[model samples]
Target: MDKDLERFVEYCKIDTQSNDTSDATPSEAKELNLTKLLYKQLKEMGLEAEIDQYGRLYSKLPGEKGLDVIGLNSHVDTALEVSGKNVKPQLISSYEGGVIKLNDEYSMSPSDFPRLKNYIGSDLIVTSGDTLLGGDDKAGVSIIMEVISYYVSHPEEKHHPIAILFTPDEEIGRGPEHFDAKKFGADYAYTVDGADVDMIEDENFNAAHADIVIEGVSIHPGEAKGKMINALRLCNEFDASLDPDAKPEYTSGREGFNHLMAMNGTAEKASMHYIIRNHDMDLLQKQKDEFVSIKHRLEAKYPKAKINLDIVDDYKNMHEVFLKDPRAVEHADEVFASLGITARHEPIRGGTDGATFSFNGCPTPNLGTGSYNHHGRFEYLSVKDYRKMIEIVKAIVKA
Candidate 1:
């Protein structure tokens, strides 16, 4: 087995699912298990590595004088959307290009995901139907570790200084909450947290989170006819007011979305959490304004009810910041072309730590690790594509 694949499977077995409700940097103590492992490995390789109180692992590899310092980053925590515990990885040495039955309850079919056809005869790493594979970023983590190992072994190979960062809670949008760009000492960086081998994302969504709370008047069943205001009903009304076609399921490419992530509560008090995204700042603001407008109109209709809305800015598009200095992405493009890999530039439908790092002055772009069907039971990784990513990283560093 490839060392990177071995490392990936080993890390996936550890449950590091982050918590959004926690106020801590990592949001979960279990994430430190993986962080400690990474820090130990980096130290064993003679690299200067340390894990902070927040579980963010940082390492440095020194280069010869007059070389530019580059940063390589990936998250250690997996998404909370699905289970990441006790992952039993199934490795197919040579895929025959057909439907894969992960377990009794679920199967991955090329018909559902046409991208599977591209990996025919290549090795695939998948998870059991009950949990996610955590390949969304673990593959990235493995790739970086393997690249560092390569350079450490080949002392004759000259390269630039490398700054390695393994962050937690990226799946929860808090990966860079404690990241210090000046301390990282990198002129530019690339986040190896994207999907597919061909994708090299320079743009991402201008993201925000909206929380709506509605207070209603609860009355007795017999007297509820004229006195009661159902907060749950108002929640549905607000959901219906949004453009249904602009949701994640219905939209693609550069289109934006207003995703209602969660809703809970009784008639007396209810809360709805929504995520608004757009590549265009003006359009993102328009969607936010529409949310406020809907809340105001509903408040007027239910005069006896009280409603409160709060919109928080999460991260902006990295392209806006990185475009000013195109060296990072241009270097990646040259690397991909040199390796005979077609470079595909697309706007990331979701936010990445690179967006936060870029806004913090690192001017980071995102690279792919061949993870597919992320944050779900159908997640899988292509071994061939994973190897390509290692080469891509090596080339980027050398560039």
Candidate 2:
């Protein structure tokens, strides 16, 4: 087995699904499992690696003087939207291009996800039907690990100072909450957290998380004529008021969305969690305002009920910061071109830790690791693109 693929498979088996409700940096203790593994591996390879109190792992590879310090980053935690536990990776030596039956309950089909056709002859790493493969960022982590392993074996090929950061809770938008830019000491960085092998992402959604709580008066059905204010019904009403056409399933390609991530409550109290996203800040704010407006409308309609809406700013589009200093993207494009790959610049509909890193003083752009259908059971990685990502990392550092 390829060492990188082996690392990815090993990491995927450990459950590292982040908890959005947790205030801790890692959000879950299980993330430390992977953190410890990465830290131990880096140290064994003679690199200066350590895990912070917050479960953020930093590994440094020393290089010649006068070269700009570069950082390679990837998240350790998988998305909380799906089960990342007990992941059994199924390896396809060579894809023949058709529906891949993960199990009787689920399958990955080219007709459903057209991009599967892109990797016809390449090897694939997929998950069993019951869980996600964690390739969303595990693939990225393996690529970084491969680069470090290569440098460890070939010390004479060293070029620039390199820093490796494996973060926790990226799936929950807390990946960079405790990231110490000064400690990492990298002039620029690239997060290997994107989807396509040929694409480089510079822009991401301006994000905000909204929590709506509806408190209503609950009474016996016999005595609840005009006095009953059912919070559950009100919650349904609130969700119905939002634009249905602007949801994740309906929107794409620069279109913003108000995604209702979760909802749980009863007649007395109910809560709806939403993630609002847009490329433009002004438009994002407008979307937020719409959420607030809906809350106010609900509150007005149900005078006896209390409706509270809280919107928290998550991360902005990293492209705003990158546009000011585009040397990172330029260097990445040069490296991609050198490897016979065209740099396809695209906007990310979702957020990444790079957005937080870029805003936090390290200009970082997102690079792809041949991952597709992230955060779901259908997720898979292309072995060919995965290996190429390792080479891309080496090229970026050696350049």
Candidate 3:
């Protein structure tokens, strides 16, 4: 098997799901399993690699001097919504089109995912219906690894100084926590974390989260008539009050939405966790305002109860930074164009570690991993496009 393909399949077998509830760095200890593998592999390849206490793996592959130091980053941890454990990758030799059964329980069709038609003759790697494939960033990781491996083995082929970063908990939005850009030593970077191989992304959602706590007056059923105030009902009412159309299911292409991540409670107290996002900063604030507005309304309706709403800024859109300096994106486009690929610049509906990296000193843009339907059982990787990404990143670092 090819090195990149071999690396991807091997890494997918390990479980590295991030935990949102956990306050610890990396969120879960199991995440280090893959980090340790990367650390060992980097060492074996004679590269200077270090694994930090925060579960971040940083490495450098020395290249031609005086060239801009370029960075490549991808997250190690998978999404929290799906089960990334025991992920069995299903490989298709040549996709002729139609339904590709993952297992007895589930199957993927081009009708459901029109993009599948884009890779008719390409080899593919899919999940076995039981769990997620973890291709969201693993594919990115493999691409970076292969690129580094290529330049390392053939020192005669000159390239720019390369800084590699594999982060944890990107799915939970903590990928950039404790990250030091100056220490990364990269003038610019690219996050290989998107879907399409031909697209380059610099704009991302202005992300913020809202945590709502509802305190209610509980009374016995025997005399509960007018004194009873159920927190569960208030939580449901709070969700129902939000605009029905203003949600992820209904929004697309730079549109903003308030996603209810999780909510649970009883008659005494309940909590609702929501993530609000928009490309425009003003629109993002309006969504936050809506959260505060509903809290006041619910409190007024249930005078005996107290409602606490906390909204915190997570990450801003990286577009602002790119607008000031377009060198990183322009460089990527030029490289892609040289490789006979038209670089499509699009806004990212979701944020990548690049968003935070751009805000920090290093201007960063997001590239793709040729993986689709991320964070779900239906997720799959296109071997042809995946290989193309390796070439694209390789071109970006060429002297």
Candidate 4:
């Protein structure tokens, strides 16, 4: 465990933040650095490991009796907010019940996030307030590495065949794009990528991407009084047509949103991208139908103006899949209880790699590692909670 934490800090020091605009598979070459390191370490532990063409790492620990294979997965890429480079982790010996200073201006405060009271006697690992701790999934990766290595080194532990997969570009929602489910050869999997320690999410949002492209005819500026149909203006009209009350910033919990991701165009043409999300299948269909109606309305207003809408379903809620197999929930609950954690089954407001993996036939769910306020400067993790999660995984495997 000590070696794992040391290696995790080293891994976080390398900037592996994925770029949303990049066309490459890994999105950034720096991501491969961790994959290479993990591959070497897995091989050193005398296990089979390799980095695939798409820069994902897959390793296996063969088990006796050929029982249903269990898989543990985590992503290596961090969010693109700040440079993940030169990460310096600070370990707090024990919570003193006051604000812990990271720098002159910044400190992790219980006043802002009252959940800090939950870990009053627990240890913590935080950043220098200048960069993210990268504990989102890096901590998960470290736990998986430590647990798997321990089991491999001590064969006396009775556990099912385990598969470990490290994915890239998960921060950008493309982790499953390059994944081959059939090749993974696992009965089921769990993404050790949740925010809080006892969180186990089997339900997530049904996500889709919408692209609206508007084409308008631009005449001479001098005679533009009657002939100019600005595409940029139409984009705003389209945005205002959606439900204003249902947005990420305004809504929380099960509430969904029509997020306006990007917009770009000249007078002749304009394009806007939106991501629509909802948990209810019926509501998701209604949202798309409304978008189609909006497209027709714009076309009617301007006969010469052309508008096209493209919608693609990303992933669906995994509730049905989990319902089909009761063992997954029962096993996780049993393990969390054994570790003295109150397991909470909640719906993920956002999508996860497990959601895609579930749709792709893995029936995967998300498990937590005790991270909070992710993708921001205030992000911090519970050191004790993090270590407890490793024990939880081991218990789950044995169960």
Worst 10 residues of 4 by lDDT: 1-10
Q: Write candidate 3's Cα lDDT for 1-399 as tens digits.
A: 666888999999999999999999989999999999999989999999988888889999888889999999999899877899899998898899989999898999999999999989889999999999999889998999999889888888999999999999999889999888977889999999998999999898999999999999999978999998999999999999987877999999989999999998889999999999999999898888888888888888888998989999988999999889888998998999899998898888887789889989899999999999998999999999999999999999999
The candidate 1 region of ten consecutive residues with least summed lDDT is: 61-70
Mark the regions of model 3 whose C-alpha exceeds 4 Å error after superposition: 214-244, 261-271, 293-307
Local distance difference test scores for all models: 0.89, 0.89, 0.91, 0.84
Q: After aligning candidate 3 to the native by TM-score, how far in Å is the CA of 181 from where it should be?
A: 1.4
Give the winner by TM-score.
4
Write the residue-wise lDDT of candidate 4 on 261-336 in tens digits: 8999998899999999998878888888889998889889988898989999988888877878756677788878
Distance from true location, Cα of 221 in model 4, Å = 7.4
Ranking under TM-score, best-scoring first? 4, 1, 3, 2
Order candidates by lDDT, high to low: 3, 1, 2, 4
| Selected candidate, larger lDDT, 1 vs 3 | 3
- Can you write out model 2's per-residue Cα lDDT over 1-399, one digit (the tens) per residue? 877888889988888899999887679999999899888889899999889888899889998789889999999999877898889999988899989999999988999989888889889999889999999789898889989889889988967889889999888878888889998888899999887777889999998999999999999989999999999999899989988787999988899999999999999999999999999999898899888889888878888899989999987999999889887888899998998988999898887788888988899999988878888998998888888788888899994
**Count of backbone clashes, every candidate in sequence:** 0, 0, 0, 0
Q: Please, what is the TM-score per model? A: 0.89, 0.85, 0.88, 0.91
Best by lDDT: 3
TM-score of model number 1: 0.89
Task: Give stretches of model 1 more than 4 Å off.
Answer: 101-106, 215-238, 263-270, 295-305
* Error at 231, model 2, angstroms: 6.6
